[model samples]
Each structure stands twice: as structure tokens, then as C-alpha cells.
Target: MKRLLALTLALLPTLATAGQITLILSDKIETSDGKICLYENAVKSEQVKVTASAQCRHTMTFED
Candidate 1:
């Protein structure tokens, strides 16, 4: 299937640049200001940056 092979080759770049972020509830702790906050699992990715905590009860995935 030449067409299928061509299609797959055309999509290779998109797939290579695409990425996902996974956040999982790690802990609940108090801040210095006496406020409660949620902490999520640490994410290490050069393409994604997490600036805030996650308040989800389950795992979450975000694609871009």
C-alpha cells in the first residue's frame, strides 16, 4: 500500500512533536500562609511546564 506508507510518513513529524502531560495527586500540604494546597506528581519535560498544582482526584493527561 503505497498510499498508506506515504500517509504514515507524512504524519511522522506530527507524532514526533506531539507530547502529553500526566498529573497525579501526590499530596496535600499547608503553605506558609496557612493555606491548604494540592501537590501533583513531578513532571519532567522540556516541552511542557506546569505552573500550578492539580486538584484532581485521579490521574489526568493533556496532549498538545
Candidate 2:
């Protein structure tokens, strides 16, 4: 049982992922000015949520 537990623990990382996060989806909205709004220069370690992953840009927009 102990060996089995150790094996599971050791193989856990292989089963999952490491370093950086997996971006599931993103949001891309068009501005009224006919410009495409994009997400970029996100703060350090920030996560953005979007309804449609395909439309998202996998980035974050910060207010200057």
C-alpha cells in the first residue's frame, strides 16, 4: 500500500501539468469605434474569464 501511494504521488505530476496556466478560452469584443478590443499586458499572474474561449485573446487589458 505504501509503495502504491508513493507511485501515485510520483506519477501525479505526469498525469497533470506544471508551470504557467492553461487558458481555456477568451473574450474578444468589438468596440463601437469599429476597433477590435484586445486583451494584452495583463498584470502579473492574473486570470481573465470569458464566455467564449474562441473569441478571447488570452490576455488582460489594464487601464492606464
Candidate 3:
């Protein structure tokens, strides 16, 4: 998680001037009770939602 965050931070400067940048990170995990949990970043695009599982998603949008 730290690495992911670091990577995202590292890329921010480059992407800042690149118009709009959308970063999506997702992960699926099973809880202690054996329940499948989905985590994802909130996105309004149906296309993204349909293509990506919400099993731990982190979405970050940046615009220049």
C-alpha cells in the first residue's frame, strides 16, 4: 500500500501537466469471516465499473 501511494505521488508531477489523469487501484480480499469483500475507488463511468471489480479500488483523478 505504501508503495502504491508512493508511486502515485511520484507520478503526480508528470501527470499534472498531462491534461486529465485517472488512476485506479483495486484489490480483492477475504475477511476473517470468509466473506469476499470488494474495494474500489468511486467512479461515475459505467464502463470503468463494468470492466473493473470494486474489490479494493482507489481512484484518483488529476487535471492540469
Best by lDDT: 1
Give candidate 2's TM-score.
Answer: 0.27
Q: What value does the lDDT take at residue 32 in candidate 1?
A: 50
Instruction: List model 1 lDDT by residue over 1-64, tens digit each.
Output: 9999999999998787678656664544544534333434555322222323533344545663
Summed over model 1, clashes come to 0
Q: Candidate order by TM-score, highest to lowest? A: 1, 3, 2
Instruction: Flag regions of model 3 displaced more than 4 Å.
Output: 19-64
All models: lDDT?
0.52, 0.47, 0.50
Please count the clashing residue pairs in each candidate, in the order shown.
0, 3, 8
- lDDT digits (tens) for residues 15-64 of candidate 2: 66544443322334545433343443333333444443234454433423
Please tell me which model should have the higher TM-score, number 1 or number 2. 1
C-alpha RMSD in Å of predicted model 3 compared with the true structure: 13.3
> In model 1, which range of ten residues has the least summed lDDT?
45-54
Better of 2 and 3 by TM-score: 3
Candidate with maximal TM-score:
1
Off by over 4 Å in 2: 18-64
Provide the global lDDT of candidate 3 against the true structure: 0.50
Instruction: For residues 1-64, write the lDDT of model 3, one tens digit per residue.
Output: 9999999999999776677656554544455544333333454221133223333335646442
